[model samples]
Target: MLRHVLEVLDFLDSPTADGPGTIGILERFLGDLDPSTSELRPLLETQRVVGDRGGTDFVTVTVPGRRGRMADGEAPTLGIIGRLGGIGARPEVVGFVSDGDGAAAALAAAASLLRMWRRGDRLEGDVIVSTHVCPDAPTLAHDPVPFMDSPVDVATMNWYEVRPEMDAVISIDTTKGNHLINHRGIALSPPVKQGYILPLPDDLLRIQEIVTGGPAVTFPLTTQDITPYGNGLRHINSILQPATATDAPVVGLAITSAAVVPGSASGASHEVDIALAARLAVEVAKEFGAGTAVLYDAEEFAKVNDLYGSLAHLQTLDGARDESVLDSMEVN
Candidate 1:
């Protein structure tokens, strides 16, 4: 996993890095593993989309499991979304910024999974990994540090990265700009369902402990963080943005730091830290596909919903006036 993470970081930490080039690296990596058979080869797709700010390339890699829906089986699917504003705040920031950790970790996990499948270690369910590549994204000013802004809006990102086929999602992002989580390696957010923040699943904690060889570290989530991006409220980051678009239980895999680091700051990415998060994602994907891991307690969720009614309204832009309201926010 560390080797793959370093390889991905080498390619991403360049000014010429783009969607097609990054996809080429992944294809080459997978192709080198076993050039003979195409039986369990993952499906890789990339598309370039332009927006008012600029353009970005959305990449999605699907690693099918033995009993996955793609193979006419009943096993559930897991989605790993590398959520980030952009990979590089180029022209302003020289190389790959700290925010690019999500993309690097996600791509590395996909690479690792593909290698595992080719080596005959097939999982039981399908895994979909999605993220974008932008070498020249814009930057925005914030309180403690500046953020790497996206070429597109949050809605555009969710539309492309979040898939309806994902039964459960692990949204990975760099969450080091805040004072709340002071950990240095990685941390997990509690499972968030339709609108309620469910208790942290014990299965995930066990997985985290095994992956890091340390006690599980979790961050707290406010109702505002789970809400949509354009709702005129401050969010920790885009880690939970996928939750707003899907009813599936969503948890955040945060690559954290003990200090407040600006997302737009270059030379802040830690390879080992990013690899740790990637390993965690891979382990979760393995268990989730086999139905051995649970994202949330369905019985508890139902009971709470029955008692408190639906809080799904928190997932929407109820108070905002219209689409133009999104422009008012700084957009982390």
Candidate 2:
């Protein structure tokens, strides 16, 4: 699995990187395995919005589920997004493509799945992968840390990346903004389903423990993190933004580090940790598709919803922007 991750890194770490380039590299590795079963789409809308700011190439790769076969459609479909502003924070960050671990991990997982399929080890459901390629992205300041700013805002990204067919999503991002989860591997966020932030699934924890051979680690996600951005509200990051678009359960697969690493910083990615996250995604796909790994308990969830009315408004869909308050207050 780590070999696959390294292979993806080699492809995305280049300076002349773009969506089609990523697809071309990945296609070389994966195209041989029943090309009809997979589909790849690259988008160029990022440049339209960013213009002189930067260039982003959005690419979506999907492995369709086969009906009646091991890889079938009846099972749940999982969407894994390598959420990031750009793979390279060019000029600003030198050498390797900074801010690209999320994309790399997602691509590695996709490649791994394709390899497994080629070897006759097929999953029960389809797996959808989406991410953008941007070499020269902007850097923005924030409290406690700085971040890699995307050329296009969050709304544009959600429109293109988040889809209705996905029953569940795991938005993978480099979460080193704060000092919350002090580890060098991965952390899972509590499932955000139907705009409600549910408790962390025990099954996912079990999988993490089994995968890492240690205690399961988690990130401290706040209500604002699940809410849609552009509302001028504070958020942990864009890891949970997918939940704002769909009613399906969304989880954050954060690749972390012991120290606070800026998203625009090069040499920040850890191959070992990335491999772990990719493996977790593959494992979750297996369990989720087989109806074994449940993200939320149906009975308990309904009870919570009944106990507390629909808090779906916090998803930022209904909340109107109050910029006057934003102007008065000193937002850091």
Candidate 3:
């Protein structure tokens, strides 16, 4: 995983990094797997979409498990989303920025999984990894530090990255632009289902402990953070954006820093930290797909909803009647 992380970082830490270039790197990595295992090769797909600011390349890699849906099996599919504004700020920042850590970690996890599959260490369910590549994304002003704004908006990102086939999602993002989490490695957010932020499951905690070789560290999430973008509210970042677009339970895997670091700041990515997050994601995918890990207690969630009514309204725009208005709203 560390090797893949370093490889991805080296590729993304360039002014020429773009979506097609990223796809090519991943293709070469997965293509190197033994040909005898070609029957289980992961599916790779990429698309280029233009927006007002610019365009980005959305890439998705589907690593089919032995019992995954793609293989006509019933095991659940896990989605690993690399949520980020861009890899490079280009003219503003000449190399890969801290914001690109999410993409690095995610793509690395995908590469490792493919290699594992080829080595006969396949998981029980499928894993879909998705993220976009934009080398020259714009930067946005914020309180503690500047943010790396996407060429496109959160809605467009969700539409391209979040898939219906994902039974659960692990949204990885570089959350270093704030003072909220004063830790250096990675931190996990509470499991979010629909509009409710459920308690973190013990299974995930164990996995974090195993991956980090230390006590589990978690970050806090506010109601505003989980809400959809363009709702006239301050969000911690785009870490939880995937939750607004899907009913499936989603947990944010944040790459953090001891001090606030601007998203567009180059030379801020830590390979060891990114590798740790990637390894955690890979372990979660393994247990979750094997039915050994649970994102949330469905029965407890239902009980809470029964007593307190629905918070699904929080998933929509404030004063908007439904989610249909999402696409119409302009995201800042």
Q: Which 10 consecutive positions of candidate 1 have the poorest summed lDDT?
A: 320-329
TM-score of 2: 0.88
Please tell me which model should have the higher lDDT, number 2 or number 3: 3
> 119-235 in candidate 2: lDDT tens per residue?
567666777777777777778898777888877667666766887878888888888877887888899999998778888889999999999999999988778788888767888
Question: Of the pair 2 and 3, which is ahead by TM-score?
Answer: 3
For model 3, the superposed segments whose C-alpha errors exceed 4 Å read 32-40, 318-332
Candidate 1: Cα lDDT at 319? 48
Q: Which lDDT tens digits does candidate 3 get at residues 1-332?
A: 89999889888887777777877887776666656643667888888877778778888999999899998999999999999999988788888899999999999998898778766788999999999888899999998889999888887889889999999999999999887899999999999988999999999999999999999999999999999888789999999999988889999999999999999999888999999999999999999999999988899899999999988888777644344534553432
Instruction: Please give the lDDT score for candidate 2.
Output: 0.76
lDDT of 1 by residue, 1-332 (tens): 99999999999988888888888988866665546755656898988878678888889999999999888899899999999998898798899999999999999999998888767889999999999989899998777888889988887788779899999999999999999999899999999988899999999999999999999999999999999987789989999988887899999999999999999989999999999999999999999999999889999999999999998887778743134523433322
Local distance difference test scores for all models: 0.89, 0.76, 0.89
The backbone clash count of each candidate, in order, is: 0, 1, 0
**Angstrom error at residue 44, model 1:** 0.3
lDDT of 2 at 146: 82
